[model samples]
Target: MPLNKTLSVLLLSLISGGALAAEAGTAFIALPGKAMLADAVRLAATVTAIDPATRTLTLQGDNGQARQVVAGPEVRNFAQIKVGDRVEVRLLESLSLELKKGGAGVRTRVDSVEAARAEDGSAPAGALARSTTVLADVIKVDAKTHSIELKGVSRKLKLKIDNPEQLKQIQVGDQIKGTYIDALGISVTPQPAK
Candidate 1:
């Protein structure tokens, strides 16, 4: 499936039929010509309902909020998830941007995907990761508003910079190379024997 579609539904998949490794944190760093930001979320949602026919699972959060997520093709162990089973999901994402002061303004791209599943077949356990990188020109930078605009081959982005000092360090003639990464992991354990 498409990246956008996969990311949108993977949360529910990770909660219902999908499982994550359960790690959480958030951090940000900035330096000359380089900056990085990362975020992670860990969740434990109960499998409240399951529809084998439609391959859908309903999950309820601790706050009583509920969401239904359809198992995607990536979910090969859908049958392993059962109602009452505790599903833990961890989603981690990061973005890094580096400045190439006098780059050719040449655009480039790279993409990759990696995944693995449990070999023991004891329970559903897996991890999926994807990454993308692009080089874009600094088409515009408004120091007054602390905003910088980047233009790639197929897309353009205008982002606000919270730090004024960081915004004043770059100019429109430079190239900014950015990398975005996202990963999801899931772990499903059956209810304890009563």
Candidate 2:
């Protein structure tokens, strides 16, 4: 359910008209690990309306709510969508935490970006993903509250540890690094005739 919520928010923000100008990009960060999590989501909706001239389509969800989305130049077949076609979207996200092994001083963050584009340089049916990793120093820990505070890349914050045992593995001044990945994609297919 959390993944679904995350995916929906990501997909809607990317596919909605508001994101028409958004482009694929990547970013990274380094920080102290307080908590880590990962998950994914897949969803589909039916096309209810389309205006090729405007490069836009309206999708009706299972709940009967209709949302309008604008296709950028990357969509190779914006003209191919039909009223009954189906649009599928998928998103994957992950976060991993680790302790620095025999390392000292600050470490640089890692960032990379990639995009799949059509012959015309459009990103139809492709993916845009961002991965960020950060290394931070643990500042404090509270076993009673199952939480820990950290300072790294930028700023300091406190987070609750889900598993008490995980808290035992980290200590003040220990280097904690975390990597996070998030991606989104969409595809369209014809609806089978009844």
Candidate 3:
């Protein structure tokens, strides 16, 4: 699937941000505010096999497990990777929510992407990162039930407010502005002279 589509699914699944918590190899950090969610995972795997023709690779993880992955068209420099090279994978995701007061009932979206590969052309390495932001209007706020509804990007979502006091402060016509980011980086390093 396209990155944008994958990101959309990820964002939708993450609408309930409380579930995005810490993992064994992942680090989760949030800002001082309660509305920010962030996490990162970094690992190093050995490239056990590679097939340039099929754009496929086999990676042996540190735990002695092997897994195969196929590179999609978005990976422009797949041919640069090599067996025995150490593949470092880093994944990161973050989401931040802010309340926009006295804003019009408008919905907006913004996105950005960045990527890079090994400059020498022979090293198997690449990185891709993307971010998305949405600004939506609050359509409903039910303090009795601590539920809120937001309309944005032509989609409506109903969410339960974690704090009843927070819900009481929010009002219809307010805005829920959210920023989400997802990034993946892969780098290959040649084996030392052995």
The numbered model that scores best in TM-score is 3
Model 1, residue pairs in steric clash: 13-18, 14-18, 19-185, 19-186, 19-187, 20-185, 20-186, 20-187
Kindly indicate the candidate among 2 and 3 with the higher lDDT.
Answer: 3
Q: What is candidate 3's lDDT per residue for 1-194, written digit by digit as tens? A: 66444334433332223222223243444332237767777666677898878877677766676666666655545676778878666678888887778684679999888766555545655667889999988899887778889998878988787766567677898888888998876667777767
Candidate 1 per-residue C-alpha lDDT over 1-194 given as tens digits, one digit per residue, 9 for 90 to 100:
75335544666555553333344689999897789999988887778899999888787766566677777655667787889887777789999998888674698888988777555546866777989999989899997788999888888889888877778788888888889999877677787777
User: What is the alpha-carbon lDDT for the whole of candidate 1?
Assistant: 0.77
For each candidate, give its TM-score against the true structure. 0.70, 0.71, 0.72
The order by descending lDDT is 1, 3, 2
What pairs collide in candidate 2?
A: 29-133, 29-134, 30-134, 30-135, 31-134, 31-135, 74-122, 74-123, 74-124
Indicate the worst ten consecutive residues by lDDT in candidate 3: 15-24
What would the per-residue lDDT of candidate 2 be over residues 113-166, giving only the tens digit for each residue?
Answer: 555533443323556677988777777878999987878666877877767667
TM-score of 2: 0.71
Please report how far candidate 2 places residue 54 from its true position, in Å: 1.4
In model 2, the runs with Cα more than 4 Å from the true position are 1-10, 13-36, 101-104, 118-124
